[model samples]
Target: MLQSLTGVEKHNIEKKQAKALFESTLWSDAQTIGVTISRGFEWDTKHIIESGWEQGKQMVVPKCNPEEKSMQFYRLNDFQQLETVYFGLQEPKPSATEAVSPDQIDLLLVPGLLFNTNGYRLGFGGGYYDRFLANFKGNTIMVASQQQKCESIPVEAFDRPVQYVLTEEGMKQSK
Candidate 1:
């Protein structure tokens, strides 16, 4: 019973933590770093979009070929250019154009239902970002509410770990 109550308390704490971190550091830091959109994460990309534009940092979103199970990224010059798609998450349309390579990104903002301090994450399990992240060497961060924290997450060989966990409260180091 005590454990159950503690879990509930932790859940609430994480939610507030996620919000506070954005208001404090992550948003401002994006001015210089490029962030990759994770379609349907719990974050309000509208703020991220506006902040990215205001800061003049290139904002990129993931584009995946479902059957291919692989992912690539594209830069959106403005938030107005983004539109709602398959998952109800806003994304920039590929207009007969290409995007910058993985190595070019300064940071990656990932979405997940759960994340651990160990850098483990459980995404939609599509393996899109998981596969792409394997080749990425830049700042990889996950923005999850506190409730999403787990003691440990199950990881497979192909699943990669993030470098940072930015919750609403503050920044938690992963690596």
Candidate 2:
């Protein structure tokens, strides 16, 4: 079903999703936000980052630390600084060395291929976000389509649940 949203349909849904996220108090109140660079059919977060920049919010993106089996958030001043890495995904350069502490981030925009209404998500099987969120103390929000919210998905002990989810339909609290 994920393949069904194409061309104009995908663009329109992404726009609506971005708009809904923009209108949320979560986005408005955040000073520093942790978000990922979307690839493929993932919700395009470029819109959110651009909007956040316009709003004067500090934008941060993750750089995977494979050795540690974790990810770290780095403050991104410009999208031009990101380079495609880690299995063809755009990430902040290692030279952009300023690390943003987890406590310093007011909101974290988590990404997932599939999510359950219960808040569990099926990631790229890296467990990077899971490790990061293990100690992160902030609001966790995911932008996804209603279709991605499934009835159930396999979960592990280390899996973490997001506090909220922002879909094209609207934002919903996830337990």
Tell me each candidate's TM-score.
0.76, 0.95
**Candidate number with greatest TM-score:** 2
Which residue pairs overlap in candidate 2's backbone?
Answer: none
Report lDDT (Cα) of residue 24, candidate 1.
Answer: 53
Alpha carbon lDDT at 90, candidate 1: 58
CA lDDT of each prediction against the hidden true structure: 0.68, 0.87
Q: RMSD per prediction, one decimal?
A: 5.2, 1.2
TM-score of candidate 1 to 2 decimals: 0.76
**Residue range 23-136, candidate 2, lDDT tens digits:** 989888899999999887777888888888999999999998789987888998888889998589899986854788899999999998788888888888889999899999
Clashing pairs in 1: 14-146, 17-167, 17-168, 17-169, 18-167, 18-168, 18-169, 19-168, 20-168, 21-168
Question: What's model 2's overall lDDT?
Answer: 0.87
lDDT of 1 by residue, 55-167 (tens): 67777777777789876678877666666766675566788334768877777888777888888899877887788887887777887666678877898998888888876
Weakest ten-residue segment in model 1 by summed lDDT: 32-41
